[model samples]
Target chain A: MSMRALTGLKPIPPSEITPREVFLDRRRFLAGATAAAAGLGTAAPALAEEMAMKLPAARNAAFSTTDAPTAKKIITGYNNFYEFGMGKSDPAASASKMSVRPWTIEIGGAVEKPRTIGIEEVMRLPLEERVYRFRCVEAWSMVAPWIGVEFNKLAALVGPTSKAKYVRFTSVVQPSVMSGVRAEVIDFPYVEGLRIDEAMHPLTILAVGLYGETLPNQNGAPVRVIVPWKYGFKSAKSIVRIDFVEDQPRSTWMKLQPSEYGFYSNVNPAVDHPRWSQARERRLPDFFASTPTLPFNGYADQVASLYAGMDLKKFF
Target chain B: MRSARAADGRFAWATSDPVRALKPLVFLLCLAPALLLVHDVLYDPEALGANPAETIEHVTGDRSMQFLLGTLAITPLRRITGWGKLIRFRRMLGLFAFFYGVLHLAAYIAFDHYFDVPAILADIVKRPFVTVGFAALVLMTPLAVTSTAGWIRRLGAQNWSRLHKAVYAIAVLGVLHYWWLVKRDLTWPMIYGAILAVLLGWRVWNETLGRQRRRPARVRARAEPGPAE
Candidate 1:
């Protein structure tokens, strides 16, 4: 079979695929372009990822954001994966040491079908692209095109028992590979949780890829949860365990600062962080300007009913 | 002896009128950080990565704290080096500290709050870090305004020195502001604290020793014939 036939993929347009020679010589092109554009007599090399891979196309139009997707470099280069380190760029620099291959996620607690599923089994499930607006509690936001299966699919496969009310997600905590785990910044094996209903929502996904390519280690490789309506930290990364529990799980941030970060970390602009205002957010790449933050990060229309009568300030 | 005197004369000439000779250099050095930030924003945007505003705010805030610490160190540094000329730069350093403090506040108001006065005021009142930082800036404003020679003369040297002692409090507040703002790592704030400790320690040590020396001289004066008698 031809390459396209074997892969069951359509042929890429010539204009879309950058030639290998041009990709190889991109540094020189970038230098000239940056010099001409800046006219500052200084050459800045473009921040191009060496591991180039083609990303998949968006599969779900309903879940995608109208906002332009954040650049791949910014999305991958800037991260808050404190498992690698504290600095935003530290994850991108140090996460390469992590081993994601042969990963397994253990499903336990109130699940009827408690089993350890391998990476291959998880990937084999139906996958779709979802463009999500990720709002950080730090008052910054980004939009990403993530490709993965819905969290409900995994939850259904495991079959949560009637007693299960909350689903807890635990990230891999290998001190040997992750240097940040060595620091006592927070308890290791970073844990996060979602209400069972929230986990079952169509918007929640077990993301494995972004921008059509397998997730970079910095962006949470292997598999991670993408909780669109909540702050980015609520979506646990590099997940290793899923526990269905009767009680709400004590997430890492909530455990660290109960008053600052609450368990129900839904994106609410009316509620402000103690240190910073949450009413506005500085969108990445547009550093000078800030736009008013939307309630539920602009996902309120779909998820508003989830917290219809609850006081957000009290919960927040 | 003649050659040594000649060499001293040449040294005096080289060091003469530090206000004229070295003030401009100190001014330029103080202005360099702000200029670099402006250049990065205008021409080389990527130098600050995806969030230039945050980077600018952080850099300016850090520079302001560094200058505050630097201003505090001038006296101790002069004592160690015996470079009386160093005294000429103290006012410039203090002014630079105030300048960077203003810039830091401006960045917060402009980029973070977007000139939202009520929001800015609310943040200062609500956040402990912002409260302490705002306190430090408020303390610095008077010091910067009364830094002129005329103001010093008007206040009298004794009152002027007393009023300026608030800088020590400002330094402490600045460090506290930094420590409170950081999420986890305390390395930078700890370093700033250590430096401030040494500077304050030197001042306390000198004051104690000077008092002891003055007491003995007073005793000696009593033993001798009184000049009035």
Candidate 2:
């Protein structure tokens, strides 16, 4: 396919999309991709045996039901910038080196059902997958097919009360496991939080895998939270704990420098970071063409109400 | 000075001093760090792993600032100790610092900006970090020019010393330039800042106490002088 064909996916309206619309759109794309792959002649039948068989349920909807290499390429190549160690390409190499086997997640804090679950148990959540454009505060972005479950189902199991105001996510902190921690470049136990409402949004996900296979460790294997509206950093990686607290929890970036990283790090263009512009972001895949970064990372329809009556520029 | 040179030429037949030749060799020794940096640019995978072009510029810039601070500290350190030989090495270190600084500025111009003059001008005006770094580079220019023996002789000792004190200003700007560039980490920049502070503090103390303690004798000798020059 031509590069122009790849770039033809226009920018989605920031405040007009719905979960139903996104779900339907992804279904259509996956269906068309499967039909295209099937027509690849004898090569498809020949390569089917050589290619590793992926579980149908675990495949990201964007790549699921399709044997197309293009779908797999997009899923792997286009992803959150943080997975690359805060650089654009760091994830592609460093993440590949990471091992994502025999993992368990410790789920504790305000949940009544506080328990340690195996990676397999976490993967078995009622699945729903969606394609999201993740925008980073560093002015780079990616579109990826995230396969996971509705976060509210996980939260509902936890038994959140009226007292619970936020859900703080913590990634695994062992320096050996996450090499980025060893440098002391950033304070560790990487944290991100969502106000109780945002945590319970249907679009918010707890992803276990992608591209029709178990999540590679570089992509927050086993399980990671995906808050589509917030900047990509808000999607905590390699999760170890989920805390339901009564107040807003402290995040890693905010604890390091509160002024630069506001708690509500929603993707708003008007609020420029002290060091760089927020007005535009370089989209991965189309690395040469930068487009205007949308507010709420173009998830305003699902999340705008969560910040009602609050000024994004001030909060940001 | 001419008679001394004529006498030295006549005596040249009497001896060939290898010590004089070693001075140039020592000058080459002072370039070890810059040469090592170029070596790192070729071998260090991490240096160019992210944005190869931008990372190259940052490494060059960091080495430049470090050498500049090292060169500036030499005078105060030499005077405090009785290490007069430090004098022979000062000019070489100062020139290397300037050479790296030139490379730092050139990379920013060529790779970072691709010689986009308008963007660079805007950055200098709009960004605090760029403004401080650019100002330091500008201040370093004149000091590098008057580094030669000919310019020192032409400018006179008194004027040369005063003009070259601009290195102190550049040191301060360099520290500030690093401090403002960090996102969340302050440890590295703060360490550099603390060292620069102590070095500059030594210079200030030396100017007030070391120079003043000797000034009275000179005053007295001049007062007792019979005729004015």
Please provide TM-scores, in order, for all candidate models, with all chains considered together: 0.84, 0.64
Per-residue lDDT of candidate 1, residues A1-316 (tens digit): 7999899999988656664324534654565566678884422212223443444545799888888899888899889999888888999887866767558999999989999987766765778889899998888888998989999999889899999999999999878868788986678889999999999999999998898877778888879999988999999999999999999999999888888999988998899888878999889877644689999999999998999899999998
- Expressed as tens digits, the lDDT of each residue in A1-316 for candidate 2 is 8666899976666444443323433554465457568885434322322322243454345422222222355445344434235444455546643444445777677777778766655655677656677677766666666678888987776687677788899887655634456666677778889888888988788886566555655567658888777887898988878888988998988987888898889998778787665766655433222467787877777678889999887888
DockQ of each: 0.47, 0.08
Q: Please state the CAPRI-style docking class of candidate 2.
A: incorrect
lDDT of 1 by residue, B1-229 (tens): 1131233565422654545455667789899999999999899988987777888888999999999999999887876565777887889889999999999999888988888899889999999999999999999999999999999999999999999999999999999999999877788999999999999987887688756775565466457876787
| Residue A30 C-alpha lDDT in model 1 | 67
lDDT of 2 at A55: 32
lDDT of 2 at A298: 77
Question: Which pairs clash inside model 1?
Answer: A55-A212, A56-A212
Q: Which candidate number maximizes TM-score? A: 1
State the displacement of the C-alpha of residue B16, model 2, in Å, after optimal TM-score superposition: 6.6
Which residue runs does candidate 1 get wrong by more than 4 Å? A1-57, B1-22, B209-229
List of clashing residue pairs for candidate 2? A59-A212, A84-A90, A84-A91
